[model samples]
Target: MSANTTSFKHVSYLWDEAEAAKLAGDEVALLIYRSNLLGADLRLTNYGGGNTSCKAMAKDPLTGKEVEIMWIKGSGGDIGTLKKSGLAALYVDRLRALRNIYRGIEHEDEMVELFNHCIYDLNSKAPSIDTPLHGFLPFKHIDHLHPDAAIAIAAAKDGEKITQELFGGTIGWVPWQKPGFDLGLQLKECLDKNPGIRGIMLGSHGLFTWGDTAYESYINTLEVIERCADYLEQNYGKKGPVFGGQKVQSLIKADRLSKAAEIAPILRGFCSSERSMVGHFTDDDRVLEFINSNDLDRLAPMGTSCPDHFLRTKISPLVLDLAKDEDLSDVKAVKEKLAPAFDAYRKMYTDYYNTCKHDNSPAIRDANPVIIIYPGVGMFSFSKDKQTARVAAEFYTNAINVMKGAEAVSEYTSLPRQEAFNIEYWLLEEAKLQRMPKPKALSGRVALITGSAGGIGKAIARKFVEEGACVILNDMNAERLAEAAEEFKKDFGKDAYATAELDVTNQPQIEVAMKAAALSFGGVDIIVNNAGLSISKSIEDHSQKDWDLLYDVLVKGQFLVTQAATAVMKKQGMGGDIINIVSKNALVSGPNNAGYGSAKAAQLHLSRLNAAELGADGIRVNVVNPDAVISDSNIWAGGWAEGRAKAYGITVDELPAYYAKRTLLNKIILPADIANACFALTGGLLSKSTGNMINVDGGVAMAFAR
Candidate 1:
């Protein structure tokens, strides 16, 4: 169909000239506003997959002259949340002048170095590799994006003809060229030939739309995409084959959803590197639909929708069939099935790298597959961290949609395997890889911290994040849990932690929290059962309600959380640590504290029992007995600290000093001290110790174990 004859889909344009004029002189503000508007829709751009630029007149810092400056999206920042700092500005004339001295550069490292030398501002962040494309364009506003609908047409076998059919003479067409200075020159030449063209469809790459204003460029992008979407719908929407049929039914012999959860940890372990984390995402509906489809085998082996996704989702996905009648739940059986498949995949990837690599290419990334597909359950995307996994998930999801769209029109085709390899191991991408900070000691580890909103639990959560662990923070207080999550995000990045408001005593809640932890990260590796309370009362004065509450929180709560955490740990087949926050009173009795002390004693014994039972599974259980930790402790707020102070014949202000004097160190125990002991127990520093007690009570003589 031709552009004139095709009825295109209607899209809502988010442009407002009034809003654009509000920040007319401020280029960065205008860019941020328009970038956010375009980025808000995933159909236009996926996470970190697009770049936008504005050519603005600004006073050069060095020479007070009004120069044309190109402000483009910087690397390693999302367009949706882009700030002024996210853009790297360069002098347009100076940047363009590099074309004179630059010969056809073959190596990406040299190209990147040449590009970096063009930076007009030393303080600006590094610009995207596509910055040259933006600089070469004549228009004042330009946007380069990997819109799925646009990519559906761009990735087709007849993509150039498809581009002509959709946009006719208004948009120019450029064949796939590895993005660099030469490609930028080629794009400029294409636009120069078609001076009236409003956009460019980059075969096997993406789309570029440009105009004199941000609104104009954004509207042009939307109109072209809408036209493509409409063309796809008219040609393939009604004619496409229905997804469900006899093949889907045949593949559903056993429950795959449950099976997926069973196999996720195993898959995670196989994909994880010693230094990099491998987070898993198994609950996306698009992933489920794609994996469950009968055409998955045919579609998955096809290359990615665009070369840009190679860095995140890899060139293709790995498919595993878990539909056999054998016991799929057994870890050993799952591992046996996966071992051969993983070996085969690695061999294939290694062969591809060896055959396609050039002298300038970076070292091959780990041959492990980033995305995994199973017949019955769903697909899983893995990465070095949760945020990257989520990004890969989004890209893969969109990739599936693009493939489906392409299949409906015709057959889906990807960039050549050689081209994909070229992009995957390109020097520019390798530079970014090299810039990534070295992984911390606990980089791939996941930890669950109960009562993490405050006190020792919060401190431990902070320590875990600092050591490069993904933490799931749980607290009974909903408000405090949210606050703690915010604080954690502020301290670390948002991907470092997740929060669950949990009442640990309840079995159902505990189970849900455990699943959340598994889904948030891959599986639980370390658990801090720090959620507890205390009631100061004699055996006679401790009422039935008070005694039950103490037991429910201090003793039974640990039991429930431990049971849940251990189930995940066993499935993971990775040894883990479980540290119970008991009390110094557990080892030595104190008057008028029977309810708290007895419950703590029960918890200590529970730890010993767990250590014995779980030793076979490579899970260690230990206790951290902390006393007089009044600073920032919620346990001391419920009239317990005041009551203890009264027993010592002192005020609450003097109680800390009194307790310090009783211990040999004569130092008051702080929350941080307890956190340090917890870290020591679980941080692989004392890996050989289990069923052991570490005291943070300033060295009490009676509490010390013989």
Candidate 2:
């Protein structure tokens, strides 16, 4: 079913009965359909945080007779983007048979292995640990979700009493229990005792609803969440300004972004002790309201109550409380404070681990935080990539909603320390982490390529993305920029890159572009100064306009872009890479090349100067000089190619062959070859080398760096 046009007051309903009818006879397909509809709304569930299931009668391969089968979301799968292959199929009887072994809670990890024997489809995905929660239940369809509204009720101090008052006898309450065989049994007992109940509220957990049919299950889940939201909404504002009223005032929208930009990199650096991380910043109203409130210090430390929220956000966020009179725009002020704060956070986490670790717990993971809360500024979250970082921030937002709702009608309560520790260090969760694929070499880095609409610039952007870095594709041509953006989005993903349309010579435009980059994927870690044009002319023939044009697009443009990017990089307190795409002409003297060659020489020297100036900040500056890369290069366009051929006494079409013949390797250079050198300098092979020039012209004796 597609998204709905109808606006919702409390919780949105997306289930389309007409659409469900199309898959009426196919129970598994119907289950997938229902799961998608429920997952479509964040009011119901967050990404990869919940599961759904359905039981159907299927023909057994051995007996040639119908037997009951269960189809459920598999391990490490998301319901919103789920496909048929993503479901795990199991024989209901085999799953039920595991009860014969009847191991206690001490053997919780062992029950996961027995599920392999219950496979109805030999090639089905491995079953999730939550399988028994649905299999042992008597319902045909079940949904286990962590909706913000439901979690607010489940996480309240008087949650049991609230559940009884809000849901009456229709929904029962289950005390805090780590999900496993024991929890499933408890749920079964609850159902057995409360025969007509629709579902039960899981304390400090989420909501679980069931129905005999897929449609019934979907509606029941929606109705229950909406009822909670309606009740919370009715009582929410009756208690005066939320969160004990605001204690601190927020910065204007513009200053908020600038302050956030100043804060994001330092926080990101703190989190990167184990490995580099990408950052995401949010300055929305909801975050501002929570962080600026009087209860922020109290509520934030209490932590997120939902397991899904806690896992992504960590046990507690690192909170930065600004002095009332201190300036938020001072990078030096913030950095000095963050250094101590980071140290304290790491020590605190390590202490927590040492205090609560099981003998067999996974060795201490990274002690850095995944979320940070800064009052009057904004929130910053970090992870291995932009998407994960963004989701981490979003999950924190969901936590904010829950905290607000719970505080309105009842006191907010987080999971007890022991309970939160048990879930965080759970062996099953450790196994899931181990299963993730290795990250690419350039993973978590963000690159911005100027003149990336086509040719060498576009090729460099593509290479960075292929190596797992997010890129911002910038060019002056709107049409080409759109086309490049479309291709990158299609080939990689929507989050792989963002596009900025601006001329490199424009300082205002350059500033705007860098801001867009910060907003798109946190901050820029790499810059490729590649926007330029070539003018082939002799001393007597060269015009003032020609010299100015070459300098404006090549020399001055690089300076402007670098100047703007440096502010963000230094503020981030994270060292970065700057690659200048100069030319062979920079070091060699050739006929009819005075204008182009001189500008390139200036660019080369400018890069060396930047390398020396920014070295204290750990920012590396380098140059990639390419020659005769004619395949997709715009430099060999207009009259430049023909004029160069005429000067060499060859036809315009022979430019490629002539340039290759002069090279030491006798090879025609391509865009990918230039891309390789850029990657090598920034990808850590020659990471220590800076202010160095690497020629990508195959080989040119005269142009070689000495």
Clashing pairs in 2: none
Count: clashes, candidate 2: 0
Residue runs of model 1 more than 4 Å from their true location after superposition: 1-12, 16-18, 61-63, 105-108, 242-246, 249-259, 273-278, 324-328, 359-361, 477-494, 499-501, 543-549, 612-617, 664-666, 684-691
lDDT of 1 by residue, 1-706 (tens): 2222133344445666778788877867888898988888888888987899999888888789998989888887778888888889888997899888776755444666766776776778897788888888889989898888888888777788878866778889999888878788889999999989989999877999987877677778788888888787777546545233224432352344445555677777777643445566664655666676767777788768587676688878888866624465567777887889888888889999999998867777788898887655666777777778878878888887687667766667887888788788877778888998987767778899889999889998998888878899889899999889889988898789877889988898787677666666767789999998888876777799999999999898999999988878877777789999998899997788888888999999999999999999889999999989888889989788877877677898998889899999999998888878888887777888899998889899899888
Model 2, residue 39: distance off in Å is 1.5
CA error at residue 493 for candidate 1, angstroms: 6.1
* Clashing residue pair totals per candidate (backbone < 3 A): 0, 0
Cα lDDT for residue 194, candidate 2? 88
Model 2 TM: 0.95
lDDT of each: 0.80, 0.88
The root-mean-square deviation over C-alpha atoms between each candidate and the true structure, in angstroms, is: 3.7, 2.5
Those runs of model 2 whose alpha carbons end farther than 4 Å from true positions after fitting are 1-8, 323-330, 649-654, 661-666
Candidate 2 per-residue lDDT, tens place, 110-174, comes to: 99988999999988888998898898888999999989999898999988899988877889888
* TM-scores of the candidates in the order shown: 0.91, 0.95
